[model samples]
Target: MDKSTEEKIYEAARKVFILKGMEGARMQEIADEAGMNKALLHYYFRNKENLFKAVFKDIFTKFFAKLKDTLLSSATTREKLTVFIDNYIDLITANPYVPSFIINEINRDPKVLSSLMFENFMEPAKVLKLFFNEVESANKSVVDPRHILTSLMGMLVFPFVARPILQMVLFQDDKVAYNNFLEERKEVVKNMMFKLIEI
Candidate 1:
């Protein structure tokens, strides 16, 4: 198939997957969204699972590529944590549906997370080691770096994952209000991290 046609199908599939999720999304719907026939979509992807896997991998890459770069960089731990928080807030805010979609699919099929993890080759342990080294160099009070990392991740991601309820309860179902709240969280999360690390 031509590159343009493939891109059209990819984008369409991404939309359908994000909106309807893996089990709910239909091949015909994706074809309609792509302005192509179902046969053409199948020609490129072979099946819905294949198409979903491609879309899932693409979303996962977009979400984590910046994180990997920031964590692996030579910046100080404080600086790395700050940058990571900022990047994470920006990424999740821009693609709010991504977290929920991935979480929901992982819940439906436990293997989804494992497959994505293997495909991404993300060694979170190394990132945690960087955190541990930072704390040791600073001679801070001893603590499990895993807890710190999990706390940081949970703080950053929870709002996006719980957006629907938050929007209703906190923002009166106003999208603009909810978005402003997220924008505020960028600084809030950074400050919280700084406080946690005593930077």
Candidate 2:
């Protein structure tokens, strides 16, 4: 029961923090969002900063865990990459501000991110091995895993972070259309990536 209640508070706090950021989020707003009392929220988290840290760490931890699982799975490279992109897009859509939120947090305090996450959240060796194996099997020496990873991040994240500009300039502020565009990007990104790595 306590664990479940904590999750509820985390979910509510995540939404509030992502929506309004750390400085703007209020305890009552989080309580209201969680359908709990302000005192109960404090009982669980003590204050907004603590709650923010917990939520920030919790969400990213789970997010990267999913990605790592996909990497470590027995699935084919294409399958792994597809699932990886799908999960990443899903998280970005749900928590749109995460990329920017992370950037701002890191800029604010460089040590904050390292302290928040587990030591082994991402293992560079496993990740590089997976991508390199794919490249070697395809016999494509020219295809760079580094490029794919960097490009994938930009393609997936740029749309969400630049939402206001893109939605206004190209989308004309059409919410549904812009969202549909993002949803469609899952496959579009997959196909584009497939072209690079798939034999």
Candidate 3:
């Protein structure tokens, strides 16, 4: 029961923090959202900052776990990229607010951003660099793997991140259309990547 209540507070705190932001949210609001009293909220988290940190770290860890496995596994470079894109898209699509939540919080605290950047979050970039090094060492005729990675990131991440505007300009508020766009992208991204590498 204690653990369950704590989880409820955390969930409510996360929702309030992401929606209203750390500066704008209040303990009472979180308490109300959690269906608990403000005293109960303080009992679990000392303050909004502490609660925000817990929520931010939890979300960041989940995001990086997917990246870490895809990058560190024994998959081929192309295979890794494909898996990464699909996994990444799946995550963001399910949690549409996640990108905004992350970007907003990072803008507020760059130090936190730097810490995450240097941490396990960078596994994908490191993997791409290693792949580039391997192909170059073998004297294989290929464009830079970094370029391929960048292109894939652009193709996959940009659409999801820019969804608000794209919804207006391109997708036209049709959720089905946006979904189809993403579905097509799974193959479109792979083909574009293969073309970029000429492999």
Candidate 4:
């Protein structure tokens, strides 16, 4: 019932889930990692799914909150894009397991994406408007902004999602090399987006 105890459980669960993923993680392992009994772990979280949901939602909420703040700032749309891509790559690099875990869970159960209690805090429509304004300012034909958004997301996230194969095939399983690749990708994605939108 103590807040510190709950925090300990949460942190333990987060590490276990990150390392083992949803299906592979066990409540007993989390309990052991937290230095708590299984009963206490269940008392705090009810089940593995509930604990995973809490962790997943917290990570996504924090990420979207940062994204929302950046998008709403007074910077130019191009500047926002650079900032967004840089921050996103940094987050994914730091939490390497999160993107793949989220994508896998969503693929296994589509409802998981919708079940998160967070509101549409990212305000995607407003972000899309920024894209549209940028395109218009560039005197480009009004294309669907969703395509641009998806491209940006895919470019930034795909490497993290496909990290294993990328590391094996591209970096000879050299982790340091792959990490450097990710760092380089931040600038590459920004340049690619600028070229695509002629910004």
* Runs with alpha carbons beyond 4 Å of true place in candidate 4: 1-3, 121-141
Q: Give the poorly placed runs of model 2, Cα more than 4 Å off.
A: 1-7, 117-125, 136-144
Candidate 2, 124-186: lDDT as tens digits: 446757666775576365656667678878998899888999999988999999999999999
The best candidate by lDDT is 1
| Each prediction's whole-model lDDT (CA) | 0.82, 0.78, 0.75, 0.80
Candidate 3, residues 1-199, lDDT tens digits: the string is 4559999998888888877777888999999998889998778787777788888878877876777677667456667667876787888778767777777788888766665575645765676677667544433456665665567667877887788788778867887898888778888887876666655
**Residue 50 lDDT (model 3):** 77
| CA displacement after TM-score superposition, residue 76 of candidate 4 (Å) | 0.7
Q: lDDT tens digits, residues 1-199, model 1?
A: 4559989999999999988999899999999999889999889888889899899889877777778877877577777877788888988777878889988987898876777776565475566576678855653555566677788889988999998898999979999999888889888988877777676
TM-scores across all candidates? 0.88, 0.79, 0.81, 0.88
Query: Whose TM-score is higher: candidate 1's or candidate 2's?
Result: 1
The local lDDT score (0 to 100) that residue 18 gets in candidate 1 is: 89
> lDDT by residue for model 4 over 111-140, one digit each (tens)?
766866436533655665775676557636
Total backbone clashes of candidate 4, pairs 3 or more residues apart or in separate chains = 0
